[model samples]
Every structure is written in structure tokens, then in C-alpha cells.
Target chain A: MNVFLQELRSQRRSTLIWSLSLAAFGSLYLLLFGAIRNDISAFEDVLKNFPPVAQAALGFVIGTLKTVSGFYAFAFTYIVLCGAIQAANLGVGAIGREIGGSTADFLLTKPRARWSILAQKALAVLVLLVATNVVLLAVTIPVAAAQGPDFDAGLFVLLSATMFFVQVIFASLGLLYGVAAKKVKSVVAVSLPGVFAFYIVGLLGAVVGEDAIRYFTPFKYFDIGYILKNAAYETGFCLVAVAVVVVAVGASFAVFAKKDVQAL
Target chain B: MNVFWRELRANRKSLIWWCVGMVLMIYAGMAKYAAYATSGTSIADLMKQMPASLSAALGFAGLDVMKASGFYGMLYLYLLLMVAIHAALLGANILAKEERDHTSEFLMVKPASRSRIVTAKLAAAFVNVTVLNLVSLGLSFAVVEQYAAGENMTDEILLLMGAMFIVQLVFLFLGSAIAAVGKRPRSAASLATTVMLVTYVVSIVVDINKNLGFLRYLTPFKYFAAAPVLDRMGYEPVFVVLSALIIVASVVVTYLAYDRRDLKL
Candidate 1:
């Protein structure tokens, strides 16, 4: 418990940065909502002014804006992309840094077992990520509530929780890479583009009709659009993400325990 | 040349993935556009179909999906932004990789001068990016030509693709400069990613609200107008030239800076 607290404190700055960034994103969406909330009719009138050719260029039909579904379609796509990037970035250096600095040995050499060190680090980072999502939801709920729309708080919470799982999955995957790689440089170099490629695959899946491929991306499991509309969790997808995380983390510690740690 | 070849060799997988991913994304985008194309839906029809809320969300106004440029505009622009981000990080990390790996001392003790080494590394990074872009563009063109071709595909698309390449080049060099100047490899990568992401976010917002027009200038992306390029068959050569100047300055400054930098990793 003491060790966990110490590690948490050490991670506070990164946690704050991450939480604040997510908060800022939530604020941006609120601002988007506010724009329409101010004068819904006026906004519609402005849309009417654009030429048809100009209008088709935007992609979405304006009539859908009358419902929350409309907002989910357009805004959630960007939001999911942003959130995925955040998750990927948070994971990229989290495990790689510890392994890269050769501090895993020092940490493992302590009174605790090797598994404890890995578990504690993973939990700490996951907790930070989950905390950030909580802030995001806290900010979002009030703004959504203020808009005279009966918001589904449960759906929102579930969606936010899914974000935590998404982070865990990526973090575990990154940890696997960090543990396997011979150097930190190679880990980061390999992981950066890998994250973006996954994003592209997910985005393509979403745009096209590849529901199967969407399942491959962590983003698909905690889909913002689906949650917003259904006001419920997608249980099967969430389970898949969790199962993957558990497997990856278990594999990571197993590998880390045996691998030769070259301390700098 | 050894450094150049080594970088190319090391990055072969990345290069392949990026190119393939870009091609796949572009194909998906054009396929979406083709759906609209078949309906004989003028850009206006597509606009009318758009959810008012969605328009606000995507920040789309005066967008016509019918025009090839418009189709590419809605479809390909974001991909270009993604490519640029990838290119920037590729430039930064690849250049500083040896130093970050704690191999700089070993390499620096070799026969080559630091300047030559830096130059070769930069040249390798540039070639890698160029190949990635060319292949992405070529593959996209091939896919578009093969799978779907009904609308007027013009020189504008070629021009837009070219401008996008230039913007990508600028991002790469900017990343290289940050890598050279940054204190840590992670810091360098973070700075490059942040700059690219912020610029992209600002570019989206700036286009949404022209009152913040000045912010667009801050993003290297703002210089290329794919719509105008696709529609007019050419873009402002001056902007292309300006972007080139920035790329050259960034690469030159970063090379010089890295040469004199103490290997402190």
C-alpha cells in the first residue's frame, strides 16, 4: 500500500497533464454544444444559407442535429480518435521508460516480488487513466444536463469506464513491447506508428462496413456513439478488451521476470 | 551512406506499413465518396442529407462532396494530416536514434565527421519519407483509378497530392530540428507529436472560424488548400516555396545543431 502511494505520487504530474488534457477535450465538446444551445434555430438558418454543393461537401445531413444521435455521429468520431491517441501515448512511455532506464531491476530487487512491481505499475497507470476519464465525464455530464436534454448518466459512466479498459489494453500491449525490446529507442520507435496504424484500421472500419474489424480496435469496444444512443454498455466487447488486457499483462510479467535487465 | 542504408533497412517495416495504411485509408475514403457519386447527388444533396448537428461537429461549412476535390477534401485531408504526423516523428526519432540508443559514442569514434554523419542521417530520413509519400500517392492513385472513376479527375488532385507531400516534408524537418534541440529522446518525440497534434487541431478550428485566420498560418498544413488545388489545377506556388524554405531551414539548422551537440545520452 505504501509503495503504491509512493508510485502514485511520483506519477502525479503525468496524471495531471493527462487528466487536464481530457478535461480540455470535454470542454471543447461542451463549447460545441453551447454554440448550438444558444440559438438552435439560428444555427439551422445559417446552414440553410450554404449552397447545396457546399452543403454536400460536409458529409452529414443537417437534419440529424435535432437529436442527440446527430451529435453522437459527428462529435464522437473525433472524440474517440482523440481519446485513442491519448491512451496510446500514455501507454507508449509508461512501461518502456522503466525498462529503458534499467530501473526494473532495482524495483524487482526490492522487498516485493517481480509480479507485485509489474501489477502495481500497471494499476497505478490504469488508475490515473481512469481518473482522467472520470473528470471527463464529470465535466461532460453537467454540460449535457444543462442543455435541457435528459442525459443518461449510466451510459456516460459506462462509456467512460470503457475508456479505462482501452487504456489498460494499450498499456499492456506497450508493456509487452517494452519488455521484449532490447532498447527503449526501438520500443518507442516501433510503438508510435503501430498505434497510429491501429487507429487507421479502426477509422476505416467505422467508415466502411467492417463491424468485424472494428472489434479488433480497442476503440470499437467502448464506442462513444453506441453508448450515447443505447445508453448502455456493450458487454461482450468490453469483456473482450478486459480478457486481452489480462492476457497481455500476465504475459508481460512472465517475460519481464526472466529477461536480463541491463541497468544503466 | 552506411547510416543512410541502416536507417532505410531499420525503417523498412514502418515504411511498408505507413504506405499500405495510407493507401487503404484513401481507398476507404474514395469508396465513401463513390457512394455519393453514384446517387448523382450534387454536393447540395449530400449537404441536405447531413445532420445539422453533424455539420457543427465536423466543422463543415460550404463543403461540396461532389467535386473530386470536394470528395478528396472531405476524405483525404485528414489522412494527409495523419501522414504528416507520422512523417514528423519518423524524421525526429530516426535522426537521433543512435544517440538515443547510446551508440553515438561508438559511431562518433568512427572515421566519419559529425557533419557528414548528420547529413547522411537527414538524407536517409528525407528519402524514407519521400518514398513513403510517393508510394502512398501512387497506390492511392492506382486504387482510385482501378476501383472507381466517374467524376472529373483533374490535375488539381495531382497538385493537391504534391502540396500534401510538401507539407509532410515540412513536418519531417520540423521534427528533426526538435529532436536535435531536445534534451531527451522522449522529450523530442513528445514535442514533435504535440506540435503536430496542436497544429492539426488548430487547423480544424481555424477553418471552422475564419476569424481565427492567423492561427491557420501557424500550422504548416494551412498552406495547402486541396480544394483549390483540385478545382484550379494548381495551388499558390509561393506557399509551396515558403514551405520548402521552412523545410530547408529546419533541416539545415537541425543538422548544424546536432553536429555541435555533445553526445549526452
Candidate 2:
């Protein structure tokens, strides 16, 4: 319990920074919606000329750019990309930082068991991610509601909720990378490329229109277009996402429990 | 001179990994292009459905996707991203590693002046960027020759590679400047990556909205927009000069600060 509080306190500043940054990002995109709302047709005309594959690659849907919700969905793609990086940073750095900073020995010398320490740290990270999402939603929901009275609050909430799911998926993967790698020299070095590779894969899947490839990238798991039209996530993909997190986190605990802590 | 050799030796493993990663990325893109190329006009028709602004935003607005040069032009965005990250990491890590790894005391006690150390480190980083660019150039040419449907696009390919080299130089100095200016440098690589990402987002925003056009001046990514480079086979002279000034300024700042700043160790 003390370990969990310590981890949370230590990560508080970064969590606040990331949450504020993401909120600012969301607000900026929502503000832009006001500027272009009146001239949406002009924006549509611009989008209409884009090739189908290019449009898919960009996560833009035609005929939908006119509405505040649709435009927000389009801008949300960038938000998710940034959000993934933040989560990955937190996840990778959670365990990796102690080892990388040569402080693992100090932590390990404590009376607590390794599993307890890992659990506390992982729980702290989870709490931070949840806090970030709460702040994001609290800020974005009112701003989105201000766009129009007709705004589908429920659907908007649903769409924004997907960010948390995606973050969990990346966070678990980052945890795996943190434990599995021989040594993590720099968190960003590992996380940036890892996130971008998945992002590019998502883009490629869009361009190729391959349903199977969509399964590979977390960014595609939500399918905003389908969510907007159907008002729900694909159950199959959600199940896969859950399975991934469980396997990755379970493996991390097992490996970390048995692995010898390297002396710096 | 010793510092230069040591930096190169230390960086060799990472350099190889980066080179291999680039090769795999290019190979993957080319392999995808081969399928598109062999599919005839159907793929082009599908591409034509993309909006003009979307195409422009992607930096491949008006090119023939079937042509090897055009395809390479499209893939240039990803390549630019990889190279920029490489350059920034190199610049940030070269100087900052001494402090981060707690080895500055040993190096600082050496006979060489701080300026000499900076020059040697910078030289090593420059060499790494140059070598990586060359490898990319060689591999790109090889791929085009093997898969191209028309005449060799040697000039077009070379021009794009040159532009990427300039981009690398710009980011390299910027990274060095960030490291130099830090009071207690921790995670210089992450700081550099944040700068790169913020600028990239700014560039994309500028592309999406005409009202935000002035934001283009803020990001290095905008300075070398791929479409103009692919279509005109040249960069805007203004941006080129601006990039040079940025490089020169960063280099000057790095020297002055690094010389005066106290080592954390």
C-alpha cells in the first residue's frame, strides 16, 4: 500500500502534464470545429477530392465532415496517437526507470515481495491512466456539448471512451517490453518507434482495406465509423483486446517474479 | 580525434540497428508498391477517390502512383520520419550520454578543451547521419531498379535523399542545442522526441487549415514538404536558408552553453 502511494506520488507530475496536454489538444480541436462549422461544405468539397484509400488512411469519412461530432471524430485520431505514446511512456518507464536509473537494488532490498512491488507499481500506472481519462472526458464532454444541443452525448462518450481501451493495450505491451528487454536504455527510444509502427500498420491496413490487418493494430480496434453508425464497438475486437492485456500483464508478472535483478 | 573515434565505436551498434530498420521499412513499402503496381489502373482509380486536400496533406497530391518515383515520393514521409528521429537521437545522445552515464568526470579531466570535445562529438554524429543516408540511398536505388516499370529515377531519387540529409542536419543541431541548454539533462532523447512530435503535429494542423498557414514556419517538417520536392525536384530557397540559419544558430548555442555550463557530476 505504501509502495502504491509512493509510485503514484512520484508519477503525479507527469500524469498531470500528460492529462493537461491531452485536454488542451482536445479543446483546440473542438475550438477549430466552431471556426469551420459554418463552412463545412467547403471542407467537404476539399475532402471529396481525396482518393478513397487516402481518405481511409487518414481516418476521414466522407459526407460526415459537416457535423461537429464527425469532425471531432476525425481529429480524435491524432489525440489517440498522442494518448498511446503517453500511456506507453508511463507503462515502459514504470518498471524500466528503476532499472535504468540503477535504483532497482534499493527498491528490491525492501522487505516486500517482488510480486507485491510489481502489483503496486502496475496499479499506480493504472490509476494514473484512469485519472488522465477522467480529466480528458471532463474537459471534452462540456466542450463537445457546447458545440450543439443535438450533440449525441452518449455516443460522444462512447467514442472518447475508446482512448482508455487503446491506452491499456499499449500500456500492457509497454510493460511486457519493460520486463522482457535485457535493459531499457531510454523509454522514449522503445516506445516511440513501437507506437508509430502500430500506427503505420493501422494506416496500411486502411489503405489496403484488409480486415485481417485491422486486427493487428490497436488503433483500428475501435473503428470510429462503425461506432458512429452502429453506436457500439465490435465485440470480437474488444474481446481480443482484453485477451492481449491479460496475456501480456500475466506474462510480465511471471517473468519478473523469476528473473534475477541485474546489478548496475 | 580520440573522442571522435570513441563516439563512432560506441554508436556502431545503434547505427547498424537503425540502418537495418530503415532497410526493412523501405523493403516493406516497396513490396506493397509492387502489388499496387502490378494491379493495373484499378488501384489508380481507387486512389483517385481521395480528396485533393487529403492527398496534399499526405504530401503526395499530384503524382502518378504507378511510377517508381511517384511511389517513392509517397513513401518519403515515412522515411523522413525515421531519418529525423535518427538524427535527433544521435545529437541528443552524443553529448548527453557522458553525463547520463556518469562518465563526465573522466572525460572532463582529459587534456582536451570542451570546444574540442564538442567538435569531435559533432563530427562523429555527422558521419553517422551521412553514412545512414548513403545506405538508404543505395538501398532505395537498388529497390527501384529491381521493381521499377520505367526508366531509372536516379535524379529524382538522389534529390529526395539530399533533402532528407538536410532535414537530418537541422534536427541534429536542434537536438544538440536542447542537450546543451539543459541544467540537469535527464532523458534528452525523450525531450528531443517531444519537440519533434509537437512540430510534426503543428505542421499537420497547418496543412489542414488555411487560416493556420503561418504555423508552417514553426516546424522543420513544413520546410521540406514532400510534394514540391517530388514535383519540382527542388526545395524552396527560403526554407533552405532558414534551415541553415537554424543549424548554425543551434551549433553556436551548443558550443557556448556547453563550454560555460557546469557538469552535473
Report lDDT (Cα) of residue A206, candidate 2.
29
True-vs-predicted CA distance for residue A126, candidate 2, Å: 1.2
Error of 1 at B35 (Å): 4.0
Per-candidate clashes come to 18, 12
- Candidate 2's displacement at residue A60, Å, is 9.1
Scored against the true structure, residue A199 in model 2 reaches a CA lDDT of: 72
Which segments of candidate 2 are over 4 A away from where they belong?
A33-60, A64-67, A148-150, A201-212, B30-71, B144-152
Q: What DockQ would candidate 2 receive versus the native complex? A: 0.24
lDDT of 1: 0.68
Tell the DockQ for candidate 1. Answer: 0.35
Q: Give me the iRMSD of candidate 2, please.
A: 6.2
lDDT of each residue in B1-265, candidate 1, tens digit only: 8987887898888778777878778877776665656655454554555544445355544456655456666666777777787777887887667776677788888899888887887788788888877876676677666434575554545676777788888888899898888877656776787788778767666654455777766787778765556555677776777887888899888978887886775
* lDDT per residue as tens, model 2, A185-232: 778878887887787676564246569778888999999889988889
> Would candidate 2 be rated incorrect, acceptable, medium or high by CAPRI criteria?
acceptable
Q: Which ten-residue region of model 1 chain B has the weakest summed lDDT? A: B53-62
RMSD of each: 4.0, 4.0
Worst 10 residues of 2 chain A by lDDT: A54-63
